[model samples]
Target: MKPIDPRLLRYARATRLFLTAVVALGAVGAGLLVAQAMLIAEVVVGAFQHSMAAAELRTPLLLLVAVACGRALVGWLTELAAH
Candidate 1:
């Protein structure tokens, strides 16, 4: 295999920070999505299988909302960074 060119590294330096930001934001978004899905599943299971009261489901429901909001914020950040 050929070695990397030094000139390419020099040009890439400028984008390295932006690339890092995008990667970080993407990771955060993915985590939030997972949390949101898990929360939804929990809420469904608790309400249906376990027949949990609304009061008992409150925490998970609130967490789901927070995770959704976090995902939206991350998406906005990613878009801003890309531009």
Candidate 2:
């Protein structure tokens, strides 16, 4: 048995670009998750400490939803790229 060369590995898989995309998306998703967590913490702390109303929190909630949807879209695109 022989070891494959790193450069040739890209040719070995039809989904090489797809795999690359998945990795890139995974990185983006990680950042989004961190942002989401921070947004959640801010909302919670603000609500508790400043007595912020739900209406005031609406924008942050929407931003969170957008981040989640962006992550989902990335996953979907990766899946599409695979085939």
- Winning model by TM-score: 1
Clashing pairs in 2: none
lDDT of 1 by residue, 1-83 (tens): 99999999997997888899999999999999999999999999999999999999999999998999999999999999887
- TM-score computed on alpha carbons, candidate 2: 0.73
Q: What range of 10 consecutive residues in model 1 has the weakest lDDT sum?
A: 10-19
Q: Give the alpha carbon lDDT tens digit for every residue of 1-83 in model 2.
A: 98988878766676666778878877887898898898888889878998999899898888888988987887787677665
Which lDDT values do the candidates have, in the order given? 0.94, 0.82
**Count of clashing pairs, candidate 2:** 0
Worst 10 residues of 2 by lDDT: 9-18
Angstrom error of the Cα, residue 44, model 2: value is 0.8
Question: Each model's TM-score?
Answer: 0.84, 0.73
How well does candidate 2 score on lDDT at residue 82? 64
